[model samples]
Target: MRRILIVGAGQAGLQLALGLQAQDYDVTVMSNRTADEIRGGRVMSTQCMFDQALQHERDTQINFWESQAPRVQGLGVSVAAPDGSRAIDWLGHLDHYAQSVDQRLKMAGWLETFAQRGGQLVVHGAAVSDLDFFARTYDLVLVAAGKGELVSMFARDAERSPYDAPQRALAVAYVHGLGPRPEHPDTEAVRCNLVPGVGELFVIPCLTTSGRCDTLFWEGVPGGPLDVFRDIKDPAEHLATTLELMEKFLPWEYARATKVELTDAGGTLAGRYAPTVRKPVGRLPGGGAVLGVADVVVANDPITGQGSNSASKCAAAYLAAILEHGDRPFDEAWMQATFDRYWETARHVTTWTNAMLAPPPEHVVNMLGAAGELQPVADRFANGFNNPADFEEWFYDPAKTEAYLASVTG
Candidate 1:
């Protein structure tokens, strides 16, 4: 059996390890925290996985929370106006429902499941030196956790990475009691409110350790008024600040947020990371080569909410690559080729996500405006979240946007 060591226990690493285990390969996973620690830790993200991404989880049989989580049927976009009204508002229905499960609940459960299946679990913080030693014993070592010094092993791909600083100061609070949009009270949806230069707010329905709840997230333009979570030491204070900003910039959303409370003491989170694409292979000091996985190689900002989905796809793609390689040595050439294959799909996501960090071109703005008047345009935009690659078909180009709008409106 081919021996593989997967480092990091986030969505990608754990998913890949579990997949390999199911294949009956000799697989071992290293996690920095025990399942208990992860279960007790703060929420990791507002991971709302659309159809394709969710399908990857189902294919692997790890989607344990699907039955309990809220089914987000569509996504609504409202451009906030200076007069406290919506300048442009529309809700685009997704063909398939998306769902979010707190990482605390999912990761911990996955960690235990991996062990229950007889897969070796190493509960230790892995360093470069540790990998160098492990490489001598394991036929392949893959880095899935992007945090810590392990990230330094992958060189930044400057050509593909467009930003050096975080585009947004991100903050999130998992809460209970968030009411649905008044107009769509009977429907569950992901609400995205854009405050022009200020930034964007996302209200996502999710399932947490405490059961059904919502994630109120803010992606504040750096140094903007909403980028004020730096000193928040209390979760209640964080929720209050989130509410204050909502009241000022998104009164309609605040109308429903007034009575919401944090889901738990560790339910609030604040941080930011620049979007970057790194070389696929991580080199160790001992000349051992390890492959970087998912966010370790292509870490995009969560503004587009593609992080978890990208991770799931990355794991699935890599699993296929590994299986196909058979007994062949997992060399640098193979590692680069595997990543290149995944990038065929990921590049589209990268392009669309990076474009969003900048001011939308007039043509792009026009398309969004047109979406409000046309259901086809709205549905296309909504489903693009499931397949961001579709945006290149009509979203980015002025000519194509014009042609598409004309086709739908006429």
Candidate 2:
């Protein structure tokens, strides 16, 4: 059996390790935190997996929260005026629903599951020097660490990475007792409120460490009204600040969240990191090359919520490449080729996500206006969040968006 050492027991690392282990490969996963620690720790992300990503997990038999997690059936989009009144509001129904399981619950469960499946688990942080040591033993070493020192080993790909700094100051809180949209009380949808130059707010229903709860994810433009969670350490204080911000910028959401309370002491997180794409192959000190996976290779801001989905697809692509190599060397060329295969899909997500971070283009603004009047246009836009590749056909380009809008409206 070919031996593999996967650094970082995240969605990508754990999934790939488990998948390879099931195929009888000698897989070992390294994690900084143990399963119990992760289960008891703070929330990691607002991970809402759409149909495609969820299906990938199901295909690998690792989707454990489908029955327990809340089902997000569609997307409710609203553009808020500077004064906090809704400018344009519409509901886009999805053909297939999406689901968000808190990473604290998901990752911890997956880490334990990987061990149960006979994969070795290393409970320690691995550095570049550590990778050099691991390189000698494993046939291949994959760096799936989402952030920190290990990821810096891979040089940024200047040509592919567009941003030089963090696009938005991100803050998130998982709370219980967030009321549903008044218009759609029975429906569970990702309610996205865009504040134009200010930033965006996403109210997502998710399965938290405790139980089902709502995640209020704020993407605040630098120095914007929503950028207020930097110094708050206490969860209750964070929730209060978030509520205050919402009341000022998104009164509708504030009204819905009036009865909100933190799910736990560790329910809030706030930080900022630039979105970047890095070289797929990172070099070790002694001439060994380690392959980068998931966020380590292509880290995007949570603005589009594509992080977990992209990681899932990346694992699937890399798994296919490894299975196809069939005793061949895991060389630089193979690593590059595998990343390119995944990039074909990921590029759309990156492009779409980057586009979302900027001010809406004229055509996009027009499309949003049209969506309020047309259900098909709204549904297409809503579903685009599920499969970003669809955006290439009608969203990114002005001509395509206009033509698509005309066809739908007519």
TM-scores, in order shown?
A: 0.99, 0.99
lDDT agreement of model 1 with the native: 0.93
Each model's lDDT comes to 0.93, 0.90
Off by over 4 Å in 1: none
List clashing residue pairs in candidate 1: none
lDDT by residue for model 2 (1-410), tens: 89999999888988898889879999999999999999999888888888898888998998899999998999988999866689999999998999999888888999999898888999998888888888988899999997888887899999989998998999999999998888999999998999888888999999987899999999999787777788888888888888888898899999989898899988999999889999999999988999999999999999888889999999998999999999988999999999999999999999999899989989999999889999999999889888998999998789999899878867
User: lDDT per residue, candidate 1, 132-184, as tens digits?
Assistant: 99998999999998878999999999999989989999999999999878899
Query: Quick one: best TM-score, which candidate?
Result: 1
RMSD of each: 0.7, 0.9
Error of 2 at 316 (Å): 0.7
Give candidate 2 misplaced runs (Cα > 4 Å).
Answer: none
For candidate 2, the C-alpha RMSD (Å) to the true structure equals 0.9
